[model samples]
Target: MTSDNKDRLGSKLHDVEAAREDQWARQRDADLLEKMRERMSKTACPHCKQFLVAKSEAGVPLHVCPAGHGAWIDAPALKAVLKEQK
Candidate 1:
């Protein structure tokens, strides 16, 4: 293969690897957050046993517990961030 082609291939592979790593990191973080949320919700919220329910108020998705003590995960935050687009 030509040097230019090899360089392009290497760059593309690097980009793909970077993207995949980023996705994996975000997923791992999400999993951790979910576990933490469940533990917190079970101890904090009276309504939710070990999970926070997603609710929407005017389009902003919120991960709120029954007792109203929970955190916003990445998806919920993304939804909130997109609120301005709507």
Candidate 2:
């Protein structure tokens, strides 16, 4: 094949790779947004009145305040934390 043909093929391959990367990035961003929405729907902090973010500590699910206020752990999670201490 001629040099010009090889150059065109290379450019086409590069464009295809860039398009694939862009698609993957968009999918990742969409997944992150869905996770954030789920977390926001969980509950809000009582003290700070802001939406709590879901977190796991020592295999316990906890809703933590984003404003440095406090965390909300369910009865089961609280029991788990207490058990871990002993």
Query: Quick one: best TM-score, which candidate?
Result: 1
lDDT of 1 by residue, 1-86 (tens): 99999999999999999999999999998997677556545543444564666565565545676566664545656876778679
Per-residue lDDT tens digits for candidate 2, residues 6-47, read 999999999999999999999997896576558555677778
Measured with C-alpha atoms, the lDDT of residue 2 in candidate 1 is 98
After TM-score superposition, what is the CA distance of residue 35 in candidate 1 from its true location, in Å?
Answer: 0.5
How many pairs of residues collide in model 1? 0
Instruction: Give me the runs in candidate 2 sitting further than 4 Å from their true place.
Output: 44-86
* Candidate 1 Cα misplacement greater than 4 A, ranges: 44-86
Per-prediction CA RMSD (Å): 6.2, 7.9
Q: Which 10 residues in a row give candidate 1 its minimum summed lDDT?
A: 39-48
